[model samples]
Target: MTEPESEGMVAQESLRHTYLQAIGVQSWLPRGALPHAAPSAPWVETFTWPPTQRFEQWEDAFEDTSEVPAAEQPVLPVTPSVNAPRGVSRALESLQGMFAPEGTPSQKVLESTPPALSETTPSASALDMSYQPEPVAPLQNPLAERYPEPQFSLVLMTLGELLIVDSLPPQGRQSFSPAHIRFVSALARSLGVQGYDINPIHHHWPAFVGSALNQGPDEALRSVRRLLGNMLKSQEIKRVLLLGEASAQWILEQPEPLDSLRGLRFSLRAGVAAVSSHSVTALLRIPELKAELWADLQPLLATRT
Candidate 1:
């Protein structure tokens, strides 16, 4: 061959290899190279099928034959050859692995994710409402019913006992006991002054004294005396009766015996006459004390006149 013709053939060969490489063929054979051996027949599909055959023909084709007895038929164990092409073996292995029992890593992760707790568990309200406690009612005091405000008076009498309705004064009487009631009524008539009952320990009195005198019930004389003093002087009251030992000693600031103090006239800071007397409750308990009371009252009543 001439030099130019040889060069043209070399260029064509180079172009062919380049084209093969671009098409993803890793290797190529020379144009006149011998052909590769044909691939082995598929073991599973070696027989040809007649597409137009009836069902009966297919049954006849698959039917067992005694001429070729089961004992005479040879069985071959099919396995891939170790000497098989690497690509062919790899492809076969991947195809076999497609039907494996275990799932893919991604599939396993999806299964491992826990179900929502709300879906599996019961709600708190659904479990029970009994656990939530009922609201409690507040407490109330019967202070008004227990103690009522007294009618206005200059000569206010503080009593120790709380007279319930069952122990109330009888008809035509001002106190629970008839004798003491008569005595008090007579004294009021003689003195020309009105009398009203009060209690130092009365439920309402503490609040009254607190607001009026800025003193607590514990400072008995100071609070009660201040309150009474203000009332007496403000209302131009001339006299007050301190009944019973508690009333007299507390309001008068006098710790003298009741016997010594009874019916005695002591002047208050407000210039009101404070007459110490035996309580009606005590007079009822000991009727004989009335004589002593009458004796004591004569001097005090005489001064009033």
Candidate 2:
């Protein structure tokens, strides 16, 4: 470059540096360094700046002093004397005499005298006061231990009835169809039972027998009978009406025709009796079977009064 241009550039850089220093910004490089070749700025360490006059006064007030102030000195605890005062000394001596193993009066008397004989027999009242075995806690309810107790007695329906009932819309109605309920209610009334109240305890034939559904009818029926036994223990079921031939045949443990079994008395669980009859659903399909059902209920009616 030409001499004039180089001198002009040098003068401009000097002017910029002077301006920055005037505004309290320190020079970032050596004083005479050209602006184009300026070195990097070095980092400075930071420090916590201390407070001024007020804090200085606080420090003076908090400074420790060695001189003892003019006030009462703390009292040193007095050690007790080896010789106690008259009254306390006398009381101590009496306590020592009473508790001494060899010197005690009770000990001396016991050593000098023979042991007295114990009574030959304890009194009856003393015997009564002796420990007696605690009563055994009542056995846990057998039904609760086995399964959740179904609340209702005598569920009256065929095994396949659940299939039809479950298919229907489950809202604005009882679990069973209206017609079936009406027929059962009528049958219950005819038998002289008050309020045909029963919960639809199972849905689908499989639920009635649980996992036994895969094992054939006899196994399923056995499971159902076991379930009924639990119900008898848990609920106050007087009579379970085994509607439908499948239920009756299994529960009664007899394959006899409905004609022979309908009117006959059949024992079920220990305290419960089961009466066999045609289901109301079957009667709805074949109105003729209802006559036989009515006849079957006669024995149940006789005991109602």
Model 2 ranges off by over 4 Å: 1-175, 206-214
Q: Give one digit per residue, the lDDT tens place, for model 1 in 1-305.
A: 56555544443443443344435566533333235955432321222222122222223222334487555543322234553334433433443343223333334334555777777688776786666677866423222232233211112433221110011122222334456555555556555554544322231233342345543334433455566655554555555666666556556655566777777777764445666667766667788987776775564455552
Worst 10 residues of 2 by lDDT: 160-169
| lDDT assessment of candidate 2 | 0.47
lDDT of 2 by residue, 126-169 (tens): 67677789997653332332223221112433221111011212
The lowest-lDDT stretch of 10 consecutive residues in candidate 1 is 160-169
- Model 1 ranges with Cα > 4 A deviation: 1-183, 192-218
lDDT of 2 at 48: 11
TM-score of each: 0.34, 0.39
